[model samples]
Target chain A: MHNKTVAELSKGLAAGSFSSVELTQHFLTRIAQQDPALNSFITVCNDEALADAKAADAKIASGSASPWTGIPFAHKDIFCTQGVKTSCGSKMLDNFIPPYDSTVTRNFKQQGAVCLGKTNMDEFAMGSSNESSYYGRVVNPWGENLVPGGSSGGSAAAVAARLTPAATATDTGGSIRQPAALCGVTGLKPTYGRVSRYGMIAFASSLDQGGPIARTAEDAAMMLNVMASYDDKDSTCIERDVPDYTSTLNNSIEGLNIGLPKEFFSDHLNANMQQQVENAVKELEKLGANIKEITLPHTELSVPAYYVIAPAECSANLSRFDGVRYGHRCADPKDLEDLYCRSRTEGFGDEVKRRIMVGAYALSAGYYDAYYRKAQQVRRLIKNDFTAAFNDVDLIVGPTSPTPAFGFNSKGDDPVKMYLEDIFTISTNLAGLPGMSIPGGMIDNLPVGLQLIGNYFDEARLLNVSHQFQQATDWHTKTPKGFE
Target chain B: MSIKREDAENIARLAKLQISDEQLEKITGDLSNILSLVDQLKAANTQDIEPMAHPMDAVQRLRPDHITETDNREAFQKIAPATEEGLYLVPKVIE
Candidate 1:
């Protein structure tokens, strides 16, 4: 039951093979026994999950159950869950419980999905590895020593471990895809504004977008149907019609032109990872997709531009968390300035503070033209590069990260090396295009992701392409040794 | 432009974060490294292009200015670190 994909679970629920409460309990018990070792979850809502499951059972009995009714899923701690702690993997919000539900959680609740718990993440979605989580790092289920790439590491690990069929995750830069790649799961980041960001904590407002992480593209599509919706509450939410994402999963890709970025295949990529991606492309070719060599000239510019833009946006967004209104406050304050500084410094983790300080510096008066403004201009060229490539190809394909998951502390000393982990995944965010990471193949016993980048608002095509690849390959179906 | 130690301190103060002396040294180095990486952007020429704020060049959508929400201050304030009768408590800005 735990190993079933979301599609399989939907069929079982509709057939009355198991009650929602029973299914929910199966996952809850697995979490209790397994999560102590993984540390994938921040807070498990035991009583709430059971109650929701029971209600779902009643709803099923009444014959009003949706496909997602009673499906057990995890939410990344980035989303606000009413009455439950939405920590954003930060001590700042360690004890902060939202009085209201985030739009994403509300959408899930409306579908009657059972909430297993909130999964861990890098604090405020800042880091490439989950080590920055105040709750401690999440171990990759594949190998305990290796990291579950982050800041959506917990969601990817939870789905890979089959603790939950699928989980909601966000990508600010590579948060969702990089982790999904390392954990051997399927994750998607819809075009910016494709999903409402009303209650999802902001990292870089321009780059942050929420999507789903699941065992299969089919499962991800099912979850996306619920997660993507326009909310008037989120001013940036695109006022576009939400299609049935699962409806397009079986679409034919024959004669589809796929672009392979030349820069992504340079000497920078690991040899094993390059071979795995090459084989993945060969699989796509066998599936009747045409591969074209393309160029995103500004590819190398992404890392630097992202560092400036993301931090600049973060410094502004995080200013709302002053010691006064909500979140952690100082023990005592001699003055307002003391209150503000102490609370923030004590509340936030190192990675979060480092980003804030860098952001502040970038946006500072004298540095604005050189740093913030210059990065934005380069950001335009990056977007233009994508715009040109898409004219010749239906979609772009590349390795999600240069390599598979590394040891927990491999790049601990250097911040630049850590930032480069998202090198292959960041440009999609810069261009506000829809992108996805599907389990491509294994390298050194760890999974490498084949990233699919589609033109703006082309998620249907991306899901269709991913689903076709998944059908021809068993990469997405593989599970870690112990978890299996 | 590499960030100096004093630059990191000034940035921390502007960002409203208190950095201990030890954290200050480490942060300075990290920030400098990150900035050096970001300095790669200067290599790209952008003489005529406008700074792109969003990918889609989307203009902010306007809605009717009338009240679209009911008051939920009590529920919201319930989770505040310090609160008084229907208001958030903060260190006094004035004497």
Candidate 2:
């Protein structure tokens, strides 16, 4: 039962082989036993999960169940869950219990999916490693010493360990893909505005987009169907109809042109990891896809531009967390200024403060033209590069991360070295394109991810490409030693 | 591109975060390192390029001005640190 994909689980529920209560209990028990080692979950809603599961059982009995009805899935702590603590992996909101559901949570509820709990993440979605989380770092299921790539690390780790069949996650710069690469799971980030950001906490508004991390591309597509929708509450949610992503998973890829950026395989990438990705490409070619060498000329500038733009937006978004409203407040204050300063300093973690300070500096009086405006200009060039490349290629293929998961604490002190972990996945977010990370193979007993970047709103094609490759390879099926 | 201790202090003040002397020294070094890394953006030529604030050129969607939300202040204020008589309590801002 634990090994089944989401489709299989839904089938079982429909067949009366097991009730939703039984399935939810199975996962809850596994989490109780296995999660002590991984620390992937921030809060477990035991009573709420059982109640939702019981409700799902009622829906199943009524013969009106959707594919997701009675399915148990985890939500990253970033999404606000009504009456449950949505911590965002930060102490600032540890005591917060959202009075209302975020649009994402509301959608899952409408479809009758059971919420298992909120998963841990980096503080405010700021770091590539989960070490910055106030709840403590999440350990990689493959090796306890290695860091789970973040700020979606907990969701990726849980899916890989089979704690849940699937979980909701977000990508800002490479939050979803990088973690999925390290944990050996399937993850996707849709085009910006394709999903609503109404209730999810903001990190960088333009770069942040919500998607899913699951065991297979088909499973991810199923989750995406429920997650993507337009909401008036979120002004940026695109007013476009979403197609059924699963409808095209079996589409033929014969003569499909895939661009391989030379820059993606350069010295920044590890030699052995390169071999694994190349092997994955070979498998795709055998499935009748055509591979071509291409160039995204301004690839190196993405990191620098992202650093400036993300922080500048974050600084403005986070200003609402003053001592007066909802969130942590200082114990004693000398005045209003002290109240604001002390509360924020006490509430946020080091990484959050570092970003806030950097953001403030970037948008400061004298530095605006040199840093913020210049980064935006460079961003245009990066987007243009993708626009030019997509004219000839149906999709872009590359390694998701330069290397497999690094050991925990390896890059903690050096922020710049840590930023480089996202070198491959950032440009897609900058250009507001859809991207997915599928398991390629293993290197040094760790997993490597093959990334697929599609033209705007071309998620169906991306899912089809991923599903086809998954059929020819078994990388996504491999599980960690102890967890399996 | 090196950030000074005083610069970090000023940034912290502007960002509304309190910093200790110890935090000031460490933050200065970290800020300097990050800024230096971002300084690589100077290599790109953008004399005639247009700046992109959003990924897509989206304009703010405006609806007819009307009452769209029912007041939920009571439910929202339940999580406030200090509230009194349906109003958020804050340090004195008036004389």
Q: Kindly provide the TM-score of model 1 when superposed on the true structure, using C-alpha atoms.
A: 0.99
The residue-level lDDT of candidate 2 at A250 comes to 98
Per-candidate interface DockQ score: 0.87, 0.88
- Among all windows of 10 consecutive residues in model 1 chain A, the one with the lowest summed lDDT is A321-330
Summarize candidate 1's per-residue lDDT along A1-484 as a digit string, tens digits. Answer: 9989999999999999999899999999999999999999999989999999999999999999999999999999999999999999998998889988889999999999999999999999998889999999999999999999999999999999989999999998989999999999999999999999999998899999999999999999999999999999888889999999899999899999999999999877978899999999999999999998999999999999999999999999999888788898889898889998899989998888988888999889888999999999999999999999988999999999988999988996888889999899999999999999999999777898999999999999999999999999999989898888
**Candidate 2 on A214-264: residue-level lDDT in tens?**
999999999999999989999988899989999999999999999999999
Report, for every candidate in turn, its global Cα lDDT versus the true structure: 0.93, 0.94
Candidate 2 regions exceeding 4 Å error are none
Q: Count the backbone clashes (under 3 Å) in each candidate.
A: 0, 0
> Candidate 2's residue-wise lDDT over B1-95, tens digit each?
89789899999999999889876788899999999999999999999999997788898899889999899999999999999999998888898
Place model 2 in a CAPRI quality band: high
